[model samples]
Target chain A: MDKDKFFSNDPRFKVAKKEAWIGVGLVLFNFVWWFAFAYGLGSKSPDEYTYILGFPSWFFYSCIGSLIVMSILVIVVVKYFFKDVPFEEEVQDIQNQSDKKSS
Target chain B: MQEYFLGSRSMGGFILAMTMMATYGSASSFIGGPGIAYSTGLGWVLLSMAQLPAGYFVLMVLGKKFAIVSRRYEAITLNDFLKSRYESQWVGILAAISIIIFLFSSIAAQWVGGARLLESLFNITYPIALTIFAFSVMIYVIIGGFRAVALTDTILGSIMFFGTLILLVAVIIAGGGVTNIMEKLIAIDPGLVMPFGADGNLSASYVSSYWILVGVGVVGLPQIAVRAMSHKNSKSMHHAIIISTVFVGIIMLGMHLIGVFARAINPSIAVADSVMPTITMEVLPPFLAGIVLAAPMAAIMSTVNALLIMVSSAVVKDIYLSYFNPQAPDQKVRSISYLVTAILGVIVYLMALSPPDFLIWLNLFSFGGLEAAFIWPVVLGLYWKRGNKYGAISSMIVGVTSYILFHQFYPNAFGMHTVVLPILLSLVTFVIISIVTEKKELLQAVHK
Candidate 1:
């Protein structure tokens, strides 16, 4: 079905293509976020005794701070970006299908 | 509960959030993980954050599709989804076998963790502790079923939240300050303060692989994925995701940090798993210790209850009814479920009799097994229409076999965790086999 969608203009196909991309984008964001926090900020040791918010500078940003930041970030993305995806189909599609069945 | 496995599927946002959080935050999250952090230093704390995106992945990848499709088929267990999608009895059985084997190992580990927590808190022998926990969990699950389990998660989730918060504050005060603790850590070993971990052992490859182990691969865990199919609507799903994410974030960071700080208070703690209890007792009075102790006890009990229910449902709903007696009376099904739950509890209790001095391996094995076996099937089966029974069955067999082989012979292959290789191999198997068999399925359809 997706193979022919390239040449098709159905609105449902467009929603699906967009939805798939959104899913991929969300996954990629999570991957990069974890790598940067766990390996990037944490890759170095500075002054051997540097402290931030009672955590080692790297630990504070990467582990503790990142957790709090991610909590808010996920909530925001889910609220504003990710659409409500009902798998069965749109409510209108269901009503139309039921009418066809009865007819 | 209208459905034995999924409850009424009318869960509110709060109950949905609590059940997801409680199930995801297992005994290892409370006890074994922190114990590892106590020795591994601040690096493990950062590594633990890899789990922050766990609930995110389950809700996102499986999301609305799983719930709606499961409803369309009236499926209950995770294996029920497999049976319906692939149209194969083999797929269902293989899924059931994987859940029982891996989750049983997981259950035994949790029982050990619960018993250990009790031994430390109440000063009792190990077997006595095990008996008390086993009966308490079995009785609760037997009496209330899934609704009782979800409601208990609400109470347990609160205990986890305030419990960790209180312990974190007390630990910080006892260590003088976070700054003071950092200095004390550096004094003991300069490596302890670094991101690379104590002795610079947490390699870049090692830490990055955790992204698969705890982050994305969590979508494969049946216990967590089943929660995706139980919400009342999209709004409830959305709310559950946000709330569970916040709860997981706070507990993982706070508890692991307390593990690291335990070093500052008592530098010579003998066993790492004992770090949480020792520090909680050292920092707070006995009464508060009891309260905070409930955090881990609740963590373990809630996790065990969820696992017991899942394994029982797998045996009863997925295997027995699907194969032997599809038309079995409801009363028979009810009796069988109760009997299976009790038998499973007894088996796990016996396994935990002489707990391993270190239990990370048993728990990790279970995690890896489930991921290697189920991750590709669940994810690809849902999205890729071409995926077939050959693909599903082959993926399961190849996955569990390679996982065990790699685990026994070649762990941390090329400095990466053993699970990475099996998940990759199984995925390659799934896609290639699926494409190969796609033509046959299409041909049969055209002939008809």
Candidate 2:
């Protein structure tokens, strides 16, 4: 129930916050690149094009580029973002509240 | 009175029922149905039949354990439940971001579908129709929250059920009967009335993969997942399962079949998405058509509103409250929630303005993305003892990244949906990482 103790002092949460920033970084990167790709090359006709593995050149590049970026974000979150912080006290408090209400 | 959050009691049972139906019955049934039917023919109807068991599958798989765990954690939203169950901030963030991104796209698709339906019916500009549709939803959702959404869904669901039945009758009557329609379809192309879709292009690979996307994978969707946690007990869950299955089956089959049969009656119709509205106007009288058309609009608006609230909640509740400002006042949280929801709606509207070629594909793409991002994290977190933060993080990353990659380059990579590969890959990653990182301290606490 103590907000500061529950969040601020939790070492695991600090790690989680840092990992979230990594995710934020990935989102920002993808957003920018997608905007650029859409504006710069998305307008080109197939006649003015290159190809990759039987697909249009622009489509191929966009697919690979976005996947790489999303992969990086996923890696960061999985490797460094999550923390196993204990919330026993909070769980107990919630349980007590439910029990009281039921009775 | 406060227990309305548990399940509607003060709100009449009829209203509650209506809300449930309306919320669950979506534009996928209305606009997407007729559109698919027109393009693929009777095969599309058979393909749609996979959705009949969706509600039962989700509720049964999740069961009572899911709800108990969610409530035990004081988790109000599906994101909230996932956050607590996994005990992983990364899972929460991934779940939150995926919901925001994909649900925004999904909402935009619905908005476009709603606006187009209105434009056809009322002779209004697309922009005006969109504005009207958006405002009507925003007002009710802002006022009523989930309760309003559920109640409205029940009403909309009833309308959808009856609307499909009535339209089916009308279409059969207008087409001179099922026998005549079948002969006409046969004359044009025998494949049109066949169960494999027009031109035999439906493909076993694609049709079977939809069972994962629309059927089994629906369990992971946050909007639907929250429903499992909302029912009062196992009894309500059982009742809901039966009711939702029958309702979904009737609507999906009826709408898609009507679409396939429309071609026999009006062979000259172009722009497949407009087939439903076109067919409705032709089959029913004007005033009746207006009312009947509202069923699709109802489906669209209900879906849009649910996604809006969900995305906004993810932003306000999961990210902002939990991470950014844990000490913020309640009033501030409330205001921020409202502001974020409105802003998100605007962004989705912009994205939807120039929609992709196939609206259903766009919606399904979002569905696949969310399922991949959240399924392992939520499911494994609940059942597995060794599901640690590291595994949760890894599962989400693998799930979402592979989903995007597969969707882009090789949509049916290895003869399966993009979601299938990612879900499998993530489960492997989760097990590997969880085993490698397991510690006595982390393993000891179950309740925590």
Candidate 3:
């Protein structure tokens, strides 16, 4: 296969490259937001208490935040990020061979 | 002749074993082990039990498909597999960068954990300890690659397993058995021995969220995910599953329980992290202590080595080879791989010197970051038909951004981990975009 054929010619490659740019955006945003939170809010004071079922409020918040983020991630992955694209004829042929072997 | 560069014969069984051992080992078994025991009393042992199934779960869940897909694509790294399967450079690069960033922090934390372990064991300075630990790991990683790592990991895993058993027995014997220790812990502050943590600090939400971080979300982790890709075949996969689960479970339970039990043996201990080292030294003879202490070192080194290899591969294979020097020869790639791996290790060593107060949190922080970054990209990229470039990009952007924002400002915003929000936001972004920009041709190809 030619160089371009390996990457540029492949539709999947085109889409993946585009997605990577998006990932870059995400990382950039994360960096900015995290720095702001850390600097703006300062470190959490251990002496203070945020209660949830008799636990500190910070701990409770962390748990809730984790759940919300993960739920959203799952939905996005299942619904959008995981879309199927048509396989090239050559690639399909390879898949067929592999399937035959597995069976 | 295409001499299989990815899986070379140079990587024999011993090296492969070591690599596996090293990859699976982490600071959790060292600093967190004793820390948990020191605070929770004996109940930490029960908590450790949860880890036993970890290895088994990964192997079983991802089993056949993982190995087959990786092999078919000639994927040496987790990012490579994702790139091929999704046919997306963005997925590959995102996976690579995320691995680099998160593993950098994770590796640094391991270095710190190793240095701390050394400092506590010997009267050495933290920097010196850090240097020695970092150099040792970097050398083996650069020279041996995956094979060496696997071999070392097997040895380390064995040490961890037996070491936990030996220490557990010794602590029990010294503390006057389980019943006596429980009584002492109850007297000290009944909460210490409870399922929650010392001071009744561990909340239901926090503990459950741990399932995502250490449990299910583990699927997204490159260090672990790569394992799913490396096995020889289905039978090997099955064997690894059984072996890994039992081993992880025993070690996790044993180490954590030992952590909690140490409190009964040494209630006056101030720094929680020091509990394990102190208890081991106190319980066992000096010679035995020396031997047992190797277990933690083994754990730290193994984890460090794995992270080093992984991050290095992310840089060399996914980013460098795929993007910068796509036409570079094999020899050039090999040289770059070795050089980059060493450089990365050194940088992490520097980062590790200062060390964190709660080392477990540092490790978990990296874990959370990686999961948020890669979970949707890898999983949805595999199963979804509508997953488009727009959707994948949006999901990643949302997942990572929200994760960072929550982690910073409203960490545990809703009593959940920071990762939860970002993952959800990214998912919504992924679906909406894919549906809106649904391309008939792309959808048909991906669906078939």
TM values, all candidates: 0.92, 0.77, 0.77
Q: Mind sharing the TM-score for model 2?
A: 0.77
Top DockQ model:
1
**DockQ category of candidate 3:** incorrect
lDDT of 1 by residue, B297-409 (tens): 88887888888889999999888888899999999999999999999988898898987876766777899999999999998877776777899899989999999999889
**Model 2 chain B worst lDDT run, 10 consecutive residues:** B1-10
lDDT (Cα, 0-100) at B229 in candidate 2: 66
- Please give me the DockQ of candidate 3 compared with the native complex: 0.03
Predict model 3's lDDT versus the native.
0.64
Docking class of 1: acceptable
Q: What DockQ does each listed candidate score?
A: 0.36, 0.02, 0.03
Q: For residues A40-82, what per-residue lDDT tens digits would candidate 2 score against the true structure?
A: 4534432454445433343334433444444444434444533
Taken in order, the candidates have interface RMSDs of: 4.5, 15.5, 11.9
